[model samples]
Target: MTLVNTMEYNKDDLLDKVQEDAENLFRSGTYFCSEAVLQTINELLGKPYDENIVKLASGFPIGMGKAQCLCGAVSGGQMGLGIVYGRVEGEPMKDKMFDVSKKLHDYIIDEYKSTCCRVITRKWQGDDFKSPERKEHCITITGMVARWVANELIEDNKIQVGR
Candidate 1:
């Protein structure tokens, strides 16, 4: 059965469903920061969970020591924006994608006050991954980021209609 039929959901109920889905995804092995954000966006947009997106996000893990230039949450938001507003070669909307990315970046930074992993996890810099406090903080912040993205996309009418 389709997700809509199984859940008996209308557009108005999407946010709660998305939040629940995001929490579930987080509890699952897909705890990578970016996956949480992507899952939330997919659920909000009524898109089926895509493995490719998860796989792409798996590459980003602050605790894993990747220490990639971009924050995982920001990367996830950009990915979501790409899915929603990106374009192929010579396709229109390239500029729109950049604009949307900027918006997502601004939103993330505004919420967290800083996008740097080091800044966000100053309490456990070298071993934050090993501490329960730090782990919980990561989970909480990631969830907050996911919820913020969902709220923004929904408010801005960026989510596709009739998914």
Candidate 2:
């Protein structure tokens, strides 16, 4: 129900808007960046994967459960890529899945200069983890990650784009 330049948005636009909203809502809770992205992407993809899969992303936040390793956003984006192109047991789509994952990881690293949550957080909001500013920073990043996945879906013709 958003309007840009006084023009009503289509279904695709609405989907994007809701995903962004969901990201913020989820982040306000104990959910981390990876969980936020996974949940949002699941809904945006029309729930292609089971909602229960969000649990799989739980341990990825704060760099694999506060380990300060890989960025949770990057991990979630890779999961999203897998959700779209991954194969079930005995399937053979690893190469394709890896390719899309690499694209997402490269994009995030290139844009943010690293794939660690600590580095990303420091670069964006310093070391304050409890301030409203920090919350906003994470929310913005979550939205950006969701949008990037949506764009990739559109580019691959996996989803329709709004005109």
Q: What is the TM-score of each candidate against the true structure?
A: 0.75, 0.80
Error of 2 at 47 (Å): 1.2
Reference-based TM-score, model 2:
0.80
**Model 2: how far residue 126 lies from native, Å:** 8.7
Instruction: Choose the strongest candidate by lDDT.
Output: 2
Cα lDDT of model 1 by residue, 13-99, tens digit? 665555556655665656667777775666456564555556767766673346634667666666666666767798766676776
Q: Mind giving the per-residue lDDT tens digits that candidate 2 earns over 32-144?
A: 77887777777666787677888999888778887878977778777887888988899877787887888888887898888777877785444546776666666777767
Estimate candidate 1's alpha-carbon lDDT, on a 0 to 1 scale.
0.63
- Report, for all candidates in order, the number of backbone clashes: 0, 0
List per-candidate RMSD values in Å: 3.8, 4.5
